[model samples]
Target: MTSQFEYGSISSLQEIQRLGEIIQQCFGGSPNDWERYLNRIGAENFRVLRQGERAIAGLGIYHMGQWYGGKILSMAGIAAVGVPPEDRGKGIAYELLSRAIEELYQLGVPISVLYPATQALYRKVGYEQGGSFCRWELSVASIWLQERNLSIYPVSPINYTIFEDIYNQQAQVNNGNLVRHRAIWEQVLEPPKEEAIYAYLIGSENEPEGYIIFTQNREKQESAIEIRDWAILTASAAKRLWTFLGDHRSQIGKISWRGSPFDPFLLLLPEQTAKIIDRMNWMLRIIDVPSALSKRGYPMGLEAELHLEVRDDLLAANNGKFCLSVSEGRGEVTKGGKGTFQIDIRSLASLYTGFLTPQQLQLLDRLKATQEDLETARLLFSGSHPWMADFF
Candidate 1:
């Protein structure tokens, strides 16, 4: 029996254009703009489910890495998922994602992450909420700091490498932040159409401790500042950056940026005036279970063992008993265990990043574990709160 639909890498520009139209139909973006984006991402990075030459569903895959426990783990970033209105009920999205993760596993991508358009569909494929992407808003007038002790300089295109270095240094200490791909950097440095982006380094030229990249939007009587990205390595840097932003109080109404829930920059603020305007939970899937466990960093000097029976309906390789031994700030996985603690792959995704504790998962009825095991699991995965400043 021949299946009605075929799945493969998008083979031609015409198929790419058709996929762009399908995405536009689902996401409400200009087809031409999406077409250009698809071209830039390259046909090789996309997979589609097709009925003959017409694509019914599709998504793009980005090869990237994410930070966890101060280590970089290989990750697949899924984006642009789309299914035409008429094909919504046919299980195309599930089949497409199912095939994608299987391929990712074969390619040694230990994990996958995505910002979902809807959570239910991803849950079916063993993905769960793993971390937060929070949007913070602060009234420009609220920042009254006037510290100019550290010199600030405008960064030219040639000085962009410093920005990359500073960001990686900060990402190392945080969980779930991206080890950004070059494509992401391109988007960061490129100014929007008819708008300008300013990049600056704070502190002395020889030893810059922080950087800020932002764009100003002036709409007649109202104006705002959008922080594209920033990082601070010193106490004075935070105050200096805030002072620079406060300088725009006369013109900029508010400043907004996507960041972690426990952003250290907030600690330097004189008052708690910064409000979280938006919050998003990004999902993660353990594509290759043992590899995922081994690649992630564990808490140093705290050694313990967890016996897990992970259930995965789609990936048989992950559906078995395993022993996770943690030592020297790393984990090693082996087959066969008591299977004392049991959880499906979805619940494990959340626990893997420390986004939710084993206790919380049990409270939600997402897992079955003893109080003793829960405490052991908690110590093994404990770290900074999992959050990302990047979107997709």
Candidate 2:
């Protein structure tokens, strides 16, 4: 942290382009694509660590929300993080990410998520591998289908609202799914590039229970259908959607999902055809500890409280003890009394997302807790394994 090193948004087009060039140099993407992304998200969402007029490192901040423990939590997503090839190993990237976390904490965001190219860099800033992007691949012929009366219709532009409603219902019940904001919806529906994207809805027209968003592609006469997003609420709707996908076997060879580990569609496909083609680890950081814990939904039937001695290096405000209590599906976090368990920020991040169990952390020597505390911690942290479908 030098006096000359400033962290903030780019002020001019020249700076933005220069920053884009540096980002391109590090990220290996075309400048035009970066420009398009900046245009879509807006210039102000990006921040730079600069030495006076020179932008040495940059990161894009997204004001987003994720579902955790069956409820939506405010999340600041970090994207397009980069430093010039010349500036590597100078601590520029660390300062930029640290400042981004600090700013998000000050803005009252509870948690932060990012797709890390490497785990070590993020781990130093209290981030841990939190969730998984489990993409299931299946041959088109293998989708199980039973003949049903449910109708599947292509979603018109007028029916986007129905698609959104169905998604909200599905996301609310799943952990670590994004609560797609209005802007996000608008961004998703933007005109396609190269290949056309399709959206199909099942059930009644006015109130769709299930919908699938995907794209069709072919290379060297081998075609495949890629499922970009989807949600189904009922058995019949799921049958309809899988039957709909099953209908594609004649034209497409394979299907890939942008889904989590707990996808129901996997159950509808033949076990032989269904394979996990890719699993990407996404990292999370608990920026504001109390708020992150209190705001996320917990199981309603459980009752427990723990005195947590947390260690946060980047955010001084979070470096202390706190009492966390959960009851009736809500949490109450207050200042310290007598600390029961001692944990550092990275381990806490893992605990906060239910990515790792307290007992497991204690066994790994990342958490120190008594038997009673471990049992209570397990009950407190039990829920759907945290996973994010969207990568920003």
Candidate 3:
């Protein structure tokens, strides 16, 4: 295991095929399946660590944005990090991730987030649990609602812009929802392989209030409805969509969708029959602290100033004291401060999303700050619980 390693982007199809084998071995997908996935995401985004001509570890970077405080912040979604079994426990993951994160910082990405297979390796690179991706399931038979106050109409690829408009309208008010990339949009709007996807508008085409993109999974033995993406901008639209889903109770037994822990749609249910069937916590790494602080939206008309002493072991530029001045729902970061609040970059990810309050991190010994600073930090980052309806 003393051979030299090269770390960089994949340059050839041979490298991709080799990396695809590693991915197939690590994750349980056929190489051709991964090849199609790689093609969809684009080969330019894939990076690898190589020993001679063979790729031992690799990962993919997806360019996207995350909504926070009514604004969209640029974020790199990291995915498909894989390594050969023989290469495990040799610091290969750490090396690949560190190089990839540095590359992101060099490219001026403000932050990077990933759905981690393991936290230890990501944590080593200053990534911490930033938000949640939860899958909720409800028995279709229990929906019991047939309200059709709003008109429902089928939407085709030609009018997919309606989905974007409706989704953005809902996303601006929530935290951590994706401002999806074109690749993600293509994946959502297009049917996969042999399966078919259905898209519909919840209101009239002239002024659509919401949209739903879903698929019906019916096998010989079982059937279920899987919602790919959805947004309800009005109460009537929500009722209509639920009724439409309930209409499928005759063939679909369960309906599952990705949503937040406290998804507002669940509140519309008359009873608590829906349950969280699956959940995954995604991690975030702040690549450029100042850009991250200045780019994200803040509470309007609330003026405040907070001094932070942040520590970043991986990125030197982020390791220092900084002052954040907020006004008109925007922040300006300047170097030098009283350093009243102290935290590491990893913990800041959680605070940045308002996923964890300053006090909670203080209690967990993840950060240290005085009571006054803690309250100020809380207000500076206050918002809905950070969660994503989409998983990268």
Candidate 4:
């Protein structure tokens, strides 16, 4: 282990294959199929930590443009980080992460996010906790069955365009929402060995209003169905969809859904035994201020202008503030004279994801604001708990 190590980019096809092989051996499974994974890394987003001519570690960054409230800009996502078993505990992973993060910063990537394998490691590397996604399980009989005027039909690939349009519209209006790109849709809708997948579209007056994606698992000799993603544009549509799931109570021993932490199901099912098995889902980082704020809907009939000082340890540019003025569901941002409230970019991200409240941030010493300023920040950023069922 005395060999001198050099850190740099790895792009050649042969080199990437070598890195993939090392990752497979380290993780006990193959990484994404070679060609697709490489394409995802693109030409410029892969990094390597090498010992002489041998690649000991590899990391990939996926650039995504997302709207946080209203601002839209490229955000960096760290994925597929791996190091050879022999290289573990040798600081190889840390070396690769540091390099990758710095490169993203240099490239103007304001926010970097990852689903951590170990929370402590990323926290040590300057990442902070954001949101928790709750995976809930309930008996099919848990929901009250109600007759609906809507019709339900199996969802197909042909409906993806409409499904996406509806989902994006809803997600944009909701806080703690992540903009799902086309690539994400493709992956989620077509996971491997997914023959048991099922989908249903709820239609009102012959127009689609909601959709549900689920999969049935019979491998355990128990009838269970897992709802992967579900969205409804109206209360009626939501009721119709739930009724459909409930109608199958005899065939379904248990019904599970991956949903936001604040999903009303828990309240909706009082007598049934329901569990929040998986607590956290997607982590968020604020890549752009104006864009992030503008995309989400705000509480009605409240208007305020506050200067925000956001401290980003990794990306320095997110530290400045523009004034945030909100009236009704509309908001405006302008270059302000000075900020009243002080907080870090991570704190802002936490607030954006509904994982941490302004009050909680204050308690953690992550927020720097006076009483009035704190109230203003709370009014602007506060909402129900945010959760993302999908993991990027």
lDDT of 2: 0.82
Every candidate's lDDT: 0.88, 0.82, 0.88, 0.69
Q: How high is each candidate's TM-score?
A: 0.96, 0.95, 0.95, 0.82
Candidates' RMSD to native: 1.7, 1.8, 2.0, 3.8
Could you tell me which 10 consecutive residues in candidate 1 have the lowest summed lDDT?
185-194
**Candidate 4 wrong stretches, greater than 4 Å:** 1-9, 31-45, 51-53, 65-67, 70-74, 156-159, 191-194, 204-206, 265-273, 286-302, 316-340
Provide the clashing-pair count of each candidate structure: 0, 1, 0, 16
For candidate 2, write residues 1-392 as lDDT tens digits.
65768989888898899888988887787977787778766798889998877888988877878987787888888888999888899888888888888888889998988899888899988899787888788887777586467878886664457677788888887777887655466555554566787898888877677888888887568898877778889888887888888888888988887777767656765565687888988999998989988998888888889888888888888888899998898899998857888898899888877889998999899988888988888888888777766767
Candidate 1 stretches with Cα past 4 Å from truth are 158-160
Q: On residues 1-392, what C-alpha lDDT tens digit does candidate 3 reach at each position? A: 32577888889878888888888888887867797788878999999998787788998889999988888889999988999989899888988888888888999999999998889889999999999999998999888887988889887653456688888899889888888877777666656566788888888878988888888887557798888889999989999999999999888999888889998877788899999989988999999999999999999988999999999998999999999999999999999999989999999999999889999999999998999999999999999999988766
> How well is each residue in 221-262 modelled by candidate 4, as lDDT tens digits?
778887767787877777787788888888888888776666
lDDT for model 3, on a 0 to 1 scale? 0.88
Off by over 4 Å in 2: 158-162, 181-193, 270-272
Candidate 3 segments whose C-alpha is farther than 4 A from its true place: 1-4, 157-162, 190-193, 219-222
Which model scores highest in TM-score? Answer: 1
